[model samples]
Every structure is written in structure tokens, then in C-alpha cells.
Target: MDITDNLAAVRRKKLSRRAFNRTLLSAGVGMVATPLIGTRQVVAQETEQGTIFTWGGYDVGELYTSYEAANGALPNFAIFGGTEEALTKMRGGFTPDIAHPCNAGLKRWVDTGMFQPIDTSRLSNWGDVIPELVAMDGNDAGDGQPWLAPFDWGGTSITYRTDLFELEEEESWDMLWDKRYAGQLGSLASGGDAWWCGAIKAGVPFGEIATDEAFEKISAAMREQRPLIRVYTDDTTTLEQALSSGEMAAAMTWNSSAVALASEGIPVRFARPKEGALTWVCGLMVHKDAPNLDKAYEIIDSLLSVEAGKFMINDYGYGHSNAKSFDQFDAQTLVGLGLSKDPGDILSAGHFMIPQSQEWETRMNETFEMIKAGF
Candidate 1:
């Protein structure tokens, strides 16, 4: 599909709720969506705050309020559909001042030699950031400097409509595999998420995911699912639209989708699969040759602020790295959002994606894409 006009429109500004998901589909990214309460309004201005290469939804004015207060305008942004795509561009010499990639690919990203260790001392809000998130696997860049500044944390699980979808049993990842919902189930296109979810369904442990035997098992499991899925897309808009209209009974989605839908009075459940949910922490990394190094730090500081945390938690339904972000909401409210004051409480209960080699990443993505293509 020639979505150049669509892509250009979405890239020009932050998106509204109605337009957000469709823009996501156009951008070739999936799962992430707009806040249920409102869309972020960004006043476009000349770039004074550097550039942040992130997913489509994070470019809002609210997350950058502190940075904008310090500088005159928000940073220039370049959006990508997924982390893999973001990394591929940067590796090809398209460096942004800051890039957002999650923890699972930390080692491969660090090994790429295009990034520099973030000196935590530059960030004023560093002290208030959650310790565990900061200490995630492969984050520490040797002499105590970290590779990425911890940002949002959340889970990936099935989000299904309670009213329309008949729950044959308590929610399970199997809802996506059920023959009953064949041709009505949606899935993420990126192997970064879906492949890992496949491992879980195939009963392969994260530690053994790279093994030859494990690969065959997961491939078979995915191929079994291929015939059943109506669409394989990363666009949250497409998945959420089908789900909201009752065209799809269930789908594999991030926590953000369910949060947005439930807030709008949609009868949905972000499943608590007996098999653990996939958990992750995505954060910021500075390019080695960041033109706006100081502004990059400023961007990190702004996102780490309690105010940013409040917006991320209250609106997007993701856990924030700033512990103080949880202070604004009462315990019950956080619980209702499927979050906790302590992120560890949630993270520990779920399956964290283990870091993998570049070779493994390439193979997994290739295999999953092949399966999606009916190979």
C-alpha cells in the first residue's frame, strides 16, 4: 500500500486518539497507542532540543514539558515502527541525538559501537529513578555508566473484549491460538515481541530460546498459529480497531492497548495468562556523536521527572522508572491500572525477555517473517 501521504501526515505532528492507531499502521509500528483521556498537542517549532528517535506515540508535548520549559521547543523527532527498524537505521549512519530501545536488545545495541555510556551525573532526576530498572541486564556500561536511561516498563499479553469474546476458560495466551477465533485473531508483526510470546506458548524457556531444538519447537508453534490469524500487523490501530468493533475477538497486544480501551468503557481484559506475560523496560540511549549532547541529557532528565512519570502512568498505563511518578496515584488506582508502586512486583511475576546475540536476532526475525508470509 502506498501510504506516503499517510506517513507524511503522521510524521508532521503528534497524533490524536482517532488518528493515532491508523497512523501507527501507516508507520509500520504496532501495539503502542494514544492516551485514552486525550491526545498530546505539540506546537511545532524549529529544532533546538535535538532529535529523539522513538516509537510514534512518545513524541507528545506532555512528556517533554520539563525539557520545553528549559529549552524553547521540543526536540525534533524521527519515528520508527519497531526497535529493530530503529536500530537498523542508526546502524546505517542515521544517528538521532537520542534513541529509545528496550532492554532485551541491550547487548547487541551496545556491541554496535555507535553509542556512548550515559554519564548519570548529568541527569538531575537520576537519584529518583527506580534502582532495579536502572540495573537491568546489560544496562551498566562497565565502569558504572549505563548504556540506556530507563524510561517506561510494562507487559505484553492478550487483550480481549469481555462482552463479545466468549471466554471458554480463564484468560490464557491460548485465546490467540483457539480454533474458535480463527481468522479473527490479530498479532504483532515484529519478532521482537511475537517470537518471544511464541516461545512461551511452545513451552521454551527464555534461557534456551536460542537452541536448535527450541527454534524448531517455536517455529512449529508459530506456523500452527499462522493459519489462524486474520492479520499479522504491528499497527495497534488496526488491532485495536478490529478488537473494538468486534471484528476480532482477541489479540496479542501491549498493556497500552487494553488500558486505552478499558478507559473508553470497552469491555476488555488484559489477560493474566497462567503462562507469564512478557515484560520489558524501554529507555533512552545517546548516540556517540550526538549533536545535542546536553539537550539529550535534558531530554532524559525531563522524561525521568515525576511529572513525566505521572503522565506516562496515568495516561499510557505503563510503569515509569521514576518512583515518585507512582506517588501521584493512590495504591488502588495503580492496581486498577495493573501497575504497582514497586515495578519489581509486576516485573518479577512476568517473563523478562533475555538478551540475545545479533545473529540470533537476525535468525528469529527472518524465521518469524517467513512464517507470517506463509512459507
Candidate 2:
């Protein structure tokens, strides 16, 4: 290496321990042992370099390992409970460099004109991304570009405590409303997940989910469950902890929550409801007025890396966009995790959320919020 670059690395090293790590990454070296400062916790904290507006669990260090290694610091993060809340905030003039929203909310996120198409060529790992995830319902930005860079994909199902929650029938959506578990049940506060699951329970078809009749049906179901729910939150940690401590017998949660609970030796199962689960793909979008545009691409690239995908799969039990991520696990292992080497195996079995209009989104969020407040 040139003396100029060597001198610069030394200078950066003197700045902070994190910067020293960045220097090593830049020089193509790796630390055999990560320092004790808690890298994942660092993500929950922040750095002023750039900002990633995402859901609660995504701010972990494991998912951003590549970014931290290359940039020396995890980006600043602004957490939102759901995509509806994130879009509402962004529409109200809060713009982060990057934002996360699921595939079902894609059309609404795009209609706002607050985000720009991501140029895949800029991401070094783009070629390795799963095509189906990249071509999510409305993600195309023309000429092979995409509005959102797909990151994680998975199902939203009931993660129930096996020992505490008794199953009378084939694991069904009715478990959440079994009446016996009243005040022992938990649910995600946002309509993004809860309302949809309510729809499944209400027997409202996804194709007709935007109709007025469908709204009434879904709302009624949500209201019925509200009195039964012990807590309503979008914090996966809250749900995980509740399941772990036996505070909640069952909760409507993502696959990751059950995975997290099981790793802690909690007897729990991510339920395969008889009514089918709510499946989704979530990705990152670059804000049209991003303050750190270059860094935004860098962070998105990091999320798409194999390292990030492995952590997502192994730690969080979410399917990653990188096709190569599944290579780390055998077919049987993936099956046990409620996943498959073929994305269609899991997705085709569950109901993919049908994209709705901004009007529907606004109505759903408002209605669900009211139900949650016991209105």
C-alpha cells in the first residue's frame, strides 16, 4: 500500500476504536475477536454519519456488520413501529437518508413521491439478490432498476408458547381469539400486521380487502380481539420477552420472535395457522431528499450482503434477499425454521398482502388505531 494511505489509516485509528476497525476493513483485514463494546448495541445507539429509518428489530449490529466493518460506525437510526407510521412521518417532512417499508405498502410509499429509484449497479452485491424479491409487486423503477432494495422477507404468524397455549384444533388463527387466553394474548399495535391478520380471521379476501365491506369486517374482528389482547406493541423485543417470561401465552408475531424465543430455550412455536399466515417482503428505499445519498447506498449495500443475510437467517430467522444466504443452511434446517430453499414454498402457502391505495392505508391505520385505543 502507498505511504499516503498508510498514514491516513493511522490518522483514522487515532480517532476512536471504531475508526480503527474501519481502517482494518479498508485494508482487507478482519479482527479475529470483536471488541467487548457490544457492536450490535452500538447499532441501537447511533452515529452521525447517516441515518436508516427502519422497524425496531432491524437496528441490530449483526444485520449491519458489513456496514460497521467498512464505515467504522453504524448509521444513525430512527425507529418506527410500522410502515404506516414511517410513511406518515416522512410525508409530514421528516426525511431520513433511507427508509424501510414492506412490499404491501410499496404502491402507497411510491405514490407519495418521497422516494427515489435505487440504482442496483451502485450496490456491489446487487447481482446476488433474489429476483422474485427484487421484482416485488410494484418495485420496478423502469430499465431494470427498483424503487426499494429488497432486504428481508418472511411471514407474520402467531408465535405461541407451546407449554402454556393449548391447541384444540389444527393450529388455527382462532388461537389468538380462543377466549381462554383473553388478557393473555399480545398483538402488534400497527395495522400493517394486526389488521391483515384480523382480515384472515375475519375471512375477508385479500382481493376485496380494500372494499368498504371488507373494512367493516376486518375492523369488527380487530375490535373483538382488542379486549382480549394483553398488550399491543410493534416492539419485537416486547413480544419476545413476554413469550419468554410466560407473561403472554401467545402473540401474533413475525418468525423472528419465535426464533429468538427458542434460542433462549423458551418452548415456543411459530404457528402455521389453518387460515394461512400473512406473508411479506420488506426492503429499503432512498429518500428523494436524502441528506446523505452516497452513504444511503452504502448502507443498503451492507444490508444486502451475505454476512448480513446470514445473521438475519440464523439469528432473526428471516429470509434474506440475497439468494446465497440460504446456502449457509441445509434444506432440513431451513424447513425447521419455517423457511425453504425455494422462497415460493413458504410464500405460496401464506397470503401475500395485496397492495392498497394511500386512501386504504390512511383508513386502515386510523381505524386500527381507534380499535387499539378501545374506541
Candidate 3:
């Protein structure tokens, strides 16, 4: 079935929180079991090697070619819908050598005491990784060691069908809430991204987003825009399909969706919102009680290599953390993709979602859920 058909079919079934979280990060559609790479027998035998608990589609062998070449096998893989769920599972005795979490959740993850500091010296490519990403809000743990290794970076913006929506003004977040497009707009279902997008529309600066007044204003704006949305889903594939079929005039989406849609010959544009886009950086962390420490470091190093970075930018449409990765893509291609050779420039033009307390996160998510349900 096509992506739209798959989304329609999946919507008929009840989606669990875990499934929603996974789809949120990976930007994938449909419900499927956690993909276990390699065979069960191989996984069982490779238990001595490391296992990575991460977002779906990230376990691809190409991203870890070096590790596979050395060990003659791939690491066992597990999947989690979100960082909190993964942290909960780890606290309850589910151990994986490494886990992936974004900068917005790094503080909370570190507070859980589930991850140990990364020894950059052990990662051969560490020297070439972008310094700006290395210096992001939560990368450092206040000690000499760092907690998170910079990986994929990208923006969140409006993806619209150029053939459907004529821009009266420059592209802006207001497009998503325009009354003219009521019943034809879509948005991301998760607050992790949607809330920040709302903040941008509300003109609430990123640093002030946690204040009571900011919350009130942002909440009101989201509620006002709610009726205009035809669908609120975490599935980027579905969003792309809807745009391709002219089912949705505009939707909030990540950079990857725009690339995917355009590559398929869809006349779509990934907007550089007038208020600026929402940007983020996500990466890997080793478990505090990791069993295969050496292999875990190797896995991280491989992911930081230029080869892996090329795969990420060209295939996944994300900006890699390695500065050298930009060498593979020409200047025009980077500009067309809304990326800069230096990730800092892109981040500076946009607002980066910051870490929030678990309590605040809970309340924001709960409030967003109510708004989505028309409460």
C-alpha cells in the first residue's frame, strides 16, 4: 500500500505511547514490531558484543561499516519510542551498551544517572566533530568528560506543496494556522517539536518558553490553531504522502520530509520560516553500566566518521556533526537543503529546543494532548 493508505490503516488501530515516541524521532509511518537486525540466533550468540538501543532505521549496517568490518558482525539492536521510555526500561533492568537521546533531553537523561561520560580520546573522529555541537547546552556534564556525542542535526519547519499554496508573503509559521487553510493543514503530534513550533508562532523567545506567561500565550496560540488542523500525527511519511496527493496544503515537518517529498518529484518547499525554524541536535551516549565498553566506543566512533556523516546527509537529509562531512556536498546543495557548512549558523538562525525538567515536560505534553483532543 502507499504511505497514505498505510497511515489510514494504522490509524484504525490503537497506537501505544511507545509506538508514538518511536515514530516521532524516526519520522516514519505505520506500526511495526521493533526491527531486530541480523538473525535471532546471531543476536543470541553476539550477546557478548554491544547492543544499541536507538530509534528505528538507525541500525542500518552502512552507518557502522567500520565496526562490522572489524568484528565480522553487527551489534544487536533494540528500539525505543522515546528517551524517557528507554531510561525507564534501563532503570527496570533493560541494559543496552549505548542509547540515543537529543540535546533537549540530555539534562534529564544525565540526571537519571543512566549514562557515563564519554571519553573523546577513544573516538578517533572526535577531533573533526563540529565544535559548536560539542559545546551545545548539555553535551558537557560540568566535568571534563562529555555526556553526549554529537550526531544528527536538522531543522523543523513548514513543508508545503508549492503548487497548492501561493505565498502572499514570505514563508512563515503563521501559514500553518492561517484560517484560509482550515481543514487542510496537518502538524506533528508530539509536543517535543510542536510546542516549540507554537512558541515560534507565538513570538515567545526560546529562552523564555518555560515561564508562566509564555506558557499561557503559547497554549492559547496552539488552541486557536487546533481547529485548522485536519490531522496531528508523528508520521512524516504520511505527511509527505498527503502533500504529494494534495490532501494537505501545508504541514509542520522535519527537513527529511521535505527532501523525501522533493526527491519523489513532488513540488514541495521546506520553508525557512520568517520567525526562524526549530533546530535540534541528537546523538549517542554509553550506558553507565555498559557491558561491552570497548565495542560501545567503537560504535560511536564509526557513527562519527565522514562515511557515516555522508550517509546521514545524503540519505537521511540531516546535517552530520562532523565538519568534514560538508566537503562531500557542494555549496548549492547545502543551501538548497537549508543547511550551512557550519551547523552553528543554521542553529543561530533558528531556536533550539532546550532541556526542560521532567515535571515541565509532563505538564506540557499533557496540556498538548488535551488541546489536540479539543479540550
Ranking by lDDT: 1, 2, 3
Q: How far out, in Å, is residue 225 in model 1?
A: 0.9
| Lowest summed lDDT window (length 10), candidate 2 | 28-37
State the TM-score for model 1: 0.87
Report the C-alpha lDDT of model 1 over 229-330, residue by residue, as the tens digit: 999888998998889999898999988899888988889888988898999889999999998899999999998999999999888889999998999999
- TM-score of each candidate structure, all chains considered together: 0.87, 0.83, 0.86
Instruction: Tell me the deviation in Å of residue 125 in model 3.
Output: 0.2
lDDT (Cα, tens digit) per residue for candidate 3, span 1-375: 223333554688766566657657665432232454445667578687789998776889889988988898888888876666777788898888999888888888888888899998899999998888888776677666789998889999999999999787999998998999998899988898999899999999889888989889999999999999999987677888889899999999988899988899999999999899999898999998998999999999989999999988887788999999999999888888888777778988989888888888888888899999998
The digit string of per-residue lDDT tens for model 2 on 141-237 reads 8888899999999999999999999899789999998899998999988788888899999999899999999999988888888898999987788
Give candidates' CA RMSD values in order: 13.5, 12.5, 13.4
Local lDDT at 364 for model 1:
91
| Residue pairs with backbone atoms closer than 3 Å in model 2 (clashes) | none
Once superposed on the true structure, which residue ranges of model 3 sit more than 4 Å away at CA? 1-43, 46-48
**Candidate 1 colliding pairs, count:** 2
Estimate candidate 1's RMSD in Å: 13.5
In model 1, which regions exceed 4 Å deviation? 1-47
Better of 1 and 3 by lDDT: 1
